[model samples]
Target: MGNSKKVILLGNFGVGKTSLVRQYVFRKFSDDYMTTIGVRIDKKMVAVNGQEVSMIIWDVAGESTHQKIPNSYKLGAHGIIYVIDVLRPSTYLSIEKEISSLEDLLPNVPIVKVANKIDLLTEKERIEIVNNLPLNDYVLCSAKNGSNVEDAFNKLAESLI
Candidate 1:
């Protein structure tokens, strides 16, 4: 398929938005940490149900403390994936508020709730964190280890269709 769909990755700083994209698109991960400026866009072609789908992923900068999100980055989005590092409780704490803001900005676009860095957490720890966060379409993934990375993309792509 030649069609392109805009998908966005939303989360706090260093929640692995870029890392997830790297894992999915390039199948690579790094130990270094780099903060995204305004936005970094990536593209990946994936097959869902035997049909090729192009996902244009927008990795937006982490929302500043007590600041509103940029409207321009959210426009024309087909799907949104909110990533949270399981080790960081603070990341998932304000998810309810974030989701509300996103829903208001892009009303009907499907959002996928993702808990990344699962490889760092114990099974019990993962459950404890996920239980606290709101779950619409939730997935647990480890970008460093390539666990459920494809599933996260497929879940969003499936919703796009």
Candidate 2:
């Protein structure tokens, strides 16, 4: 492995942060909705572009724009996986504010805007929703179907290196 890097999954409530992490770390998914209390940590080893890397994933409890994000959770994070459920408009709203918060708290860390739960949307709908996001590039994924789950993690690992 090259190096261990701390990466976090952050987004609004019910956006599938735990699902994404579970699918990536364990290759499993459940339909249950168990809200994360503070933060759940998981680690996965991945080989990215011939470099092995350990991705330390911090799955923080989801919160809305009205709620305050914990800066303490952002410390030591090398990358951010800002996940969004594509079927919900409210999850994607306040994206700029969230990004701004992350940037302010954890500057210089690369972020992968992940559009999760694509399984709930048709291909056209997914494309349209992704195209309309405030991000320049993002990974469209489905934790339930295990779609692009590794890719999202790999993208983050690549950024860390």
Candidate 3:
């Protein structure tokens, strides 16, 4: 086993951070939307370039006017997975702000943009959003159906290596 990598899943409320983690970790899905009150951690083993890597994921509570991402939780992250809901344009716009805040706290770590709920968007909408975003690497994922979930995780791991 190689060194375990620390990663974080961050986004606004109801953007499906828990759902994404649940799908990736257990290959399961639920229709409910429950806000995460605090940080939740999960571990998974993945192989990158023939080397075994353990991913320690920290799914932080969604950002809110009353609650912000805890400063203590942002320390020592190897990378961050910033998730946005495709059906909510506001969530997309907030990505920059989230990245900016996170960068201020954990500067120099890699960040992977994820457009979640792809299953809810039309083809044209997806193209339009993807084309305009500045992300060099992004994924249209559906945690509900387990689509591209692993790919998103693998891309982050590969970038770390």
Report the number of the highest-lDDT candidate.
2
Off by over 4 Å in 1: 64-67, 134-136
For 30-148, candidate 3 gives per-residue lDDT tens digits of 99878887888999988899988899999998874212766778788898898888777777675666677778777889888888898886899878877876555678899999999
What is the lDDT ranking, best to worst?
A: 2, 1, 3
Deviation of model 1 at 159, angstroms:
0.6
The sequence of per-residue lDDT tens digits that candidate 1 reaches over residues 34-109 is 9888889899987878888899989888763213566777888999998888888788877888788788878999
RMSD to the true structure for each prediction, in A, is 2.1, 2.0, 2.3
lDDT of 1: 0.85
Candidate 3 TM-score to native: 0.88
True-structure RMSD for candidate 1: 2.1
Report how far off residue 15 is in candidate 1 (Å). 0.6
Give the Cα lDDT of each candidate.
0.85, 0.86, 0.83
Question: Local error of candidate 2 at 71, Å?
Answer: 1.1
**Window of ten residues with lowest summed lDDT in model 1:** 62-71
Error of 1 at 66 (Å): 9.9
Give the number of colliding residue pairs in candidate 1.
Answer: 0
